[model samples]
Target: MELLLLEGVTRTIELPDAPPLTILSGVDLAVDAGDRISIVGRSGSGKSTLLNLLGLLDSPSSGRLVFDGQDVASLSSGQRDRLRGRDVGFIFQQFNLLEGRTALENVMTPLLYASGRQFWRRREIASAMLDRVGLSHRLTAMPHKLSGGEQQRVAIARSLVREPRVILADEPTGALDVETGGTVMQLLDEVARSSGAALVTITHDLAIAELASRHFRLDHGVLTPVSVHAAEGLIAVSGPAAGPATDAGEAS
Candidate 1:
């Protein structure tokens, strides 16, 4: 069951008196249920742009984006918003929680957009999700009161509260210490697997990237499959071996 697919997707921004800046060019990817994919790239390599496309936050200038076998471009703005809200989850590096909200309140925020019983039972659902992430005791804690790791856990709880089909994590552990980051990542993987959601993580750390079963490197808007030599702690371009890279779009 492919959850999302991108083929020859390209994004460009026009500038006055200068050539258009191509942020992403001919990018292709397919995400299936419960699949874990990690994309690594240097700063300013268009990783964020790609994430936006995958999350339906922005549209590509050219090419196709399919979600659950339906072309994204064919969806109206409201339809797109509904689909994104219902099927997609996002975890960011900054733990974007509201300033005055408690952990439980923050987690329940998304449910406000949901319908019927879900919205009515949002508190219970959010509480359980927080428990799953070991933040049950921090339910009433404000973002300022929780530690960095605790705040990230709250973010994770919020992301999973809706039981989305796909999870988009951007630099999820970028703000934590190495040990804490490792712990958070483990918790994230466990929760996503238990929920049966496909996970797509974008990061600059090779070690973090290696956590996924499939790995790709994005360079200059091009994606290539890569193999990780765990023992040597090195990564090498592995060519088109398996996974989404087999159908990766070429740069235009």
Candidate 2:
């Protein structure tokens, strides 16, 4: 089933010193449950703008976004907020954790706002989620106390705590080393796949994007699919340096 849908979407923005810019132009997309989609492009290629629109953090200037059979534009601001709170999970590049809060507290933050349960119950679930992310021991540690990889893991836990139907990750591995980034991306893929949620990863890394089941490249406000099969064949014939997941193979 199609869990999310966007049709004829267009978005425009104005800068103080520049003319109005069109970020997204007539974009159309449909994502089903368990779809691992990667949107790859350089900075200012409208990849993040598309992610924001998909996550309902920003409204489209024109077009329709139908999520789970409901027209998001038709909903009131409050209703849209509630929908975002319950149905969408976001993992930001910066981690976006409160400095003073412990890892467990940060994970529990979304659930607390989402669930009407008391503090103790929220803590229990939050701890479980942290354990799931392999961060149980660091539960009481503050955001600053954890390493970069650990902080990102906590962010993943927080996003998954609410068991959202869709997980939107914006440059999630941009801040980590290659090995750590791969590990984190693997964990994210596992969790989202296991939970039967569609995962949308917005990234500039072709290797990371290759790990996704579906890949699309955005250029000049247009999206084009990259055939992994063809890329894989080319890599096989080109030898070791031209591996399937290499930046060159992925960038096309």
RMSD of each: 4.3, 4.8
User: Candidate 1: lDDT of 27?
Assistant: 91
Which lDDT tens digits does candidate 2 get at residues 117-212? 634588888999899989989999998889999999999999998889999999999999999999999999998888999999887776787788
CA lDDT of each candidate? 0.88, 0.84
Deviation of model 2 at 8, angstroms: 1.1
The window of 10 residues in a row where model 2 has the poorest summed lDDT is 230-239
Off by more than 4 A, model 2: 14-19, 117-120, 228-252
lDDT of 2 at 180: 95
Candidate 1 lDDT tens digits, 1-252: 578999999999999999999989899888999999998877888999999999999999999999999999999999999999999999999999998999999999999999998899999999999999998888999999999999999999888889999999999999999899999999999999998999999987667878999987788888777865444555677755544332122210
Quote each prediction's TM-score: 0.93, 0.88
Q: Give candidate 1's error at residue 63 in angstroms.
A: 0.8
In candidate 1, which residue pairs clash? none
Worst 10 residues of 1 by lDDT: 243-252
